[model samples]
Target chain A: MKMSGAQMICEAIIAEGIKTVFGYPGGAIMNVYDEIYKQNKFEHILTRHEQAAVHAADGYARASGEVGVAMVTSGPGFTNAVTGIATAYTDSIPLVVISGQVPLSLIGTDGFQEIDAVGISRSCTKHNYLVRTLEELPRVLKEAFYIARSGRPGPVLVDVPKDITGEIGEFFYPSEVNLPSYKPNYKGNNRQIHKAAKAILEAKKPLLYIGGGAVLSGAAEIVRELAWMTQIPAVETLMSRGVMGAKNPLLLGMLGMHGNYASNMAMSETDLVISLGARFDDRVTGKLSEFAKYADVIHVDIDPANIAKLVDVDYPIVGDIKTVVEKLIPLLKEEIRTERYQVWRDILGRYDELHPLLYNDSDEVIKPQWAIERLGELVGEQAIITSDVGQHQMWAAQFYPFDRPNQWINSGGLGTMGFGFPAAIGAKKAVPEKTVINITGDGSILMNVQELVTAAEHRIPVINVILNNHFLGMVRQWQTFFYDKRYSETDLSYQPNWKMLAEACGGIGYDVTTKEEFDAAIKDAIAQDKVAFVNVAIARLENVLPMVPSGGALYNMLLEHKEEK
Target chain B: MEAVRRVISVVVLNEAQVLARVSGLFAARGYNIESLTVAPIPETDMSRITIVTKGNKRVIEQITKQLHKLIPTFKVIEHEEMVEKELALIKFPIEESLSDIQVLCQAYNGGIANVGEKMVIGMVTDEPARVKHFIEAAKRYSPIEIVRGGVVAIER
Candidate 1:
């Protein structure tokens, strides 16, 4: 059948089973928007900013295990979306972003709204295409989704010229892709799996270091099984939160900078490290020369390049996490060594007892950690929590009891400040029945505060809980600890009336300075059917504890803050 | 133990910006690309990229693996038993004896390609190591200019 380029795009999106797309349309993409108006194949959401659109798409992808789709116009629209693209790229989220470009005739001629998007995004995106003709549009769109969702998933961008969307052509969506070069290894080698199983059984101390890849590959259940059947403890990374659940006795909490004391100690003292779908990021490794010095590392990752990029791997198994873990499960069932690791468990238990995750309780004022704990207690595992980067994010990660996979989401790798509120909107859209909340710091919340209006406009009803510390809490903590308390530009005293901002955006707002008020406000906010903001004024100058001091060894953690003279 | 030189060849679909993607990977990761050569494969919509890099065993493994991750990449060749070749063209002043330069080029498997009024261009194709030796040996002739193509290698 014959169709316009714009019709073909809509058809292709429907063919891919995409129901919702976020974007901000402009002159370059007017043709597509016109077709979007004419078709009911999918819902097009108009976000306030291009960046938020991309972030919403990313959040949708991360939470639903599907490829999130977004569209934007040329020039500044594409440039604005770059940060969100990079955020998804760093965390390996499956996302497809379609950006409009100037017509083919105006390309490279410095046409208005013309930018070298494909060139700028080449390094960040997993793959990209700039469609020159209408005939290639269908294929490019099909490949974009395939590449975005397969083999260590990452964002893919497709740049379509304005003219291409108007050109008429025959539409044919390929049922399957035949790219010989893009095959992803889904099964692990039997010999390697056997060797790993044997090592797991023989080792006196073995730790399961799980990362986001496990969640991305839907291997969390299998990983949990491996840990349970082998009677081995596990440590989750920042991105891999909720993989082992909050209540599992074998789960060692998060492991890295700001990780639990016992988890870091266990990592330092383990004999064998079974890395599941996790890269040894610098933030996690902390003093690579000393990290896991006593351990023989077995890394199972789909991306072979990540196996030994920063750290040496003794046994490198390149395949999907679920498939590899499944192969090792039966082999591990043969021998259950519960007593062998008793000593290691005792040591780790003592470490946990020595310094359990704690904070000073203040009745006169609100502690950020207490607020997070209270929120978690109220919501339990029912709400899907998203957070922006800062002290608040770490507090939430530390205090929240997350037992569900994909329950806790945040900008872990890129640490983008403005990701939370918009991401919560996306997550809410992905799972409408689940309550969505954005745990944000005062400094990070305002970065995407405009999204409150997006929520109100769309009636997303995502709650934004702002821990108002009146400063960039993380940097101020650093300045207090390392620098001589010369706060510099870290102070954010000039703040808006969050209540008024929410009210003006057609949402509910509450300003609370005490615990009682916070509890009341959160409960009230959750019950409301509109976008709600609960601004809880927390103690300023608070810091994320158990710090590794950047490049220090994981074991060399500062458990408490000391007033430096 | 030490950083040694390795030659890597990658087969990639011929497309605009493919070179940028390949080179960008090296630049972003701080991998050293000592020499790089790219040309379209004959009668196919694909290109072959030959790169000479210096890294230890670990870094070399990472480099090859990273290359394979690129979407257009068809295959990455990093084999020890490989045959390598390079080409060099040297321009010498007309005053220098053409026979002497031709003898030097013959030793490296080449001869004079052009003899102009002002200069004589001598071409040579040989193993990369011998080409380096020839370039050094031709310096005694006081060549006007020297241009060396990057190494291209194939499995033996």
Candidate 2:
């Protein structure tokens, strides 16, 4: 059977089990849009901007562990999607970004809306293609989905010329991808696994350092099992915040920059560090010379390039995290449920008690931490939570207790502002049965507030809990501590009336200034299955405490605002 | 440790944008490629690309690891110890004494490939380092032009 390139794209998408697509129609993609309209098989959610489209798709993928689909026209459309592409790339989110290009003949003719989409996005994209012929469309689309969802997943772009979409072609999607060079190593070497197991068993104080890989690979169960069996305390990176149950006694909070004192201290003093699916990034391994200085590291990750990149490792096992952890579990025959780690746990417990995460609990204003904590308790542990970058994001990470994998989503790698609301929309769409919430900052909400209109118009029903601080609180906190407190452009006093803005976007809005108001607003949003905005008025001077200063070792936490010594 | 020269080869599907993907990977990681050559096999739908880069052990390992991640990339061979050669053609003014230049080129396995009315072109194929030495020695003969192709390597 013969099909046009546009139809082949649609058929391929349907074949790949992709049910939803976040897209915006444009000049070059008019034919594709027409086909989409004709078929009406795909759920195309029109975002306000191309960036939001890709980000929404990324959020969907992160939430569901499936490839997210996105489409837009060429030139500015591709340019607008660049940030989302890079954001997804850095975080290893799987997304299929389809951009309609100018006709092949008019490609270099300075055609209107013709920009080199493939070349411009080459650096950021994991892989990209500019489709030249109609016959190549199915294979390109097949490869796009295959490459996007396979082996450390990332965004893959396929630029289709406008004419190709209309040109007739033979359509056949491959049952499996045939890229020999791209087969990821999925099983760990038995020798390295044995070595890692031996190291874990021998060490008196073992710390399990986990990251997004644990959650992405669905190895949370195995990780928890290994930690419990070895009686090893664990600390997670910001990306893997919720992999361990928040109430678990052995699981320390996040480590690195804004990590807890106990967690960072544990990392510093541990005799053995069993790194699982987490790269020792600069943020996590501050002052690399001193990071885990005393530990014999056993790092396991799928990406070989990330192994021993920033820190040395005693046992480097390259394989899928889930597979590796499964292999390592049975090797530890010695039961470590005994009190060998009593001293280590006691030391960390003391740190936790001495330097607890605290914020000014002034009666006059609602604290962001209090608001987050309030919602965290009311919302189920399995609720999907996304956050924009800044103080609010830190507050959410600190206050929220996630018990399930993929429950907490945020822009971890790129730290893009305005990621949360659209991401929450995507998450809610992906998992409509679960409650999805976006905890954002006053400064971040303004970056892509137009997304509010997308939610309202589409009835995405995401609860937007904006921590309304009058200043860019995180930057202001940094300036107050690092600089001479000469607050330059950190002031965001001229922000919009968020409640009114939400209402203007045709959503229900509430202005919560106190605990009572916040409780009512949050409860109301969770009760109703509609797009709800609750702007919680938080104090401007509130800072995320227990922060390890940039380039400072993890153990050197600055507890400046603590009341006790 | 100081950076050292390394030869790497990758076999990839003979398709458009494969080269761009390989080059883009290096560029994004800030790894510099000294020289690159690619050619399709006569009977197969695959191409072999050879690249020379200078980096320390860790950097070279990282480059190799990253090269393996490319979708089109089939195999990445980082030459631990390999036989390598590069070709260089040097054009000298016709009036210059050719003996010295010819001796240097002959030692590197080449004589004058061409002797024109105004210029004499000496071609040499040898180990990359020896080719470098030949080019340096031929520079004293008032060479007008020099063209060097990328290195090709095979494991010894």
Candidate 3:
């Protein structure tokens, strides 16, 4: 059927099984918006800001594992979506970002409402295409979705010129993408796999370091089985939080700058480090050379470029983490030698017993850590917890013990402040039967607060727990330590009442000041059967403890509330 | 510990100063991609760049992180995991026997790869490391025309 480029874009989305899209209409994208109006096939969410629309779409993608689609116009509309696109890119979340552009004739001529979106978003997307012809619409959309969901997963952008969208074309969604340059290596070389297994078997003390790719590749069970069979204790990165149940004896908790002492120590001491689906970010390896100095590393990641990028690997296996682990599991002998396991366990247990997370106070305001811990206890291991960036995010990461893979979605690499709200929406949408809570800071929530409207419109009841400290707590904490408590611009004074904001967005909202109030508000929010926000006023001066100073070693962490004059 | 280094070749468009854009990408991302060599393809308006970088798997992935985003970037293939070859011509002493040098050149796939006059041109199309090793081996047979072609990659 002949259709305009804008109509074809929408049709491509529908063909790809997208039931809803989040976006705001603007000058350059008016045609696409108009086309959206004619089609009742897909629901288009009108957001207060372009940023919120992109974030909402990002949330949808994370939850559904389908490509989250968002549409925005030129200039500011496209610019606003940059942060969300970067967030999705850094976390390897699949997203399809469609932005309208000024006409081809007007491009590079300082045209009205025009900005070089392809240029601006170049660093933040997997691949980007500027559709110059209506005939190219279907192919661009197909490639965009293919690139977004394939190999390590990231955001792809298709910038359609406004005039092109009105041009006629015969639309057809190709069942396959034949990009010669885009073939991703999914199987490890047999020699590399053998070398990895040999290294694992020969080492006296081996550590299995897993990351978000484990969950992305569905290798959580295989990771656990490998650890169990090899007698290696496993340490997870922040993105891989729920890959292994926290209660498992072999699980050594998160390993990074903010990771537990045991995990960090295990990483430092292990003779053989078998890292699966995890990049060696500077956060995880304080001083790259010093990190795993004693270890002969066997790095396995689906992205081939990530194999020897950070810490050097003795054996590099490039393939899907699940595939590599599945292959390696049978190659090694399963003779259970409990000696190395007991030694590591004893060390980790001692550290856990020594520097246990503690909070001492009888303050009227509810402690954010305690609130998160209670939520973890109340929801048990079934709930998916998403968080925004701040002190609250750190607390949730520390206190919430996830028992399954793909739970605890948060912005890790990019550290985007407002990711929690939209991510929760996506998680809730993906698994509607399971409870999803967005534990966000007041500063972070305000960044993408408009997503509440999307949640309300879709009837996705994602409970948002706002840790209202009236400050960008993390920055404020940094100022307190480094700037001699001047309090700079971190304090957010003129904040709207969250309850009123939620009400205006057509969702339930509650104000909680104490532990009892927080518990009651949570109960109420959970029972509302609608998108709800529980705003709990938390201590403003609170800091995320065990912070490894930038460029400092992992062992050199500054504990919270340390003894002082 | 001393840092290890690997040389990488990137093929790109040879247009209005695209070298800066490629170099800027590496610089802005804090990726120290060392010793970059960019020159136009003999016939076409495309440039091939060879960059020497130091990293493990993670670092290399991060270096090429945004390469695909460049508008003019048609493709990015890391030559380390592919079948690659580079050609070099060296002018040696005329007294040196052609047969002896040809035997050595044949062993490195340089004999038939290329041939010239006073300069016994040899071509070695192997892995980048093997190419480097071949270049080092050719250095012993001193002749003049020492020119090396930019690296190109093709997956096996």
Clashes of each: 0, 0, 19
Tally clashing residue pairs in candidate 1: 0
User: Which of the predicted structures, 1 or 2, would earn the higher DockQ when compared with the native?
Assistant: 1
Indicate the TM-score of model 3. Answer: 0.83
Angstrom error at residue A510, model 1: 0.8
Give all TM-scores, in the order shown: 0.98, 0.97, 0.83
Query: Which ten residues in a row are the worst by lDDT in model 1 chain A?
Result: A556-565
Stretch of 10 with least lDDT, candidate 3 chain B: B112-121
lDDT of 1 by residue, A124-209 (tens): 89999999999889999999999999999999999999999999999989988878788999898889888888888889999999
Q: Candidate 3: lDDT of A367?
A: 74
DockQ of 1: 0.84
lDDT per residue (tens digit) for residues B17-76 in model 2: 789888888887899899999999789999999999988878888899888877777889
Question: What is candidate 1's lDDT per residue for B8-126, written digit by digit as tens?
Answer: 99999998888998999999989999899999999999999999999999889989999999999999999689989999999999999999999989988999989999999999999
**For candidate 3, lDDT tens digit of each residue in A286-380?**
87767888889899987766767666778988789888889898888564464746776687678767766566554666778788888988886
> Over all chains combined, what TM-score does candidate 1 have?
0.98
lDDT of 1 at A105: 98
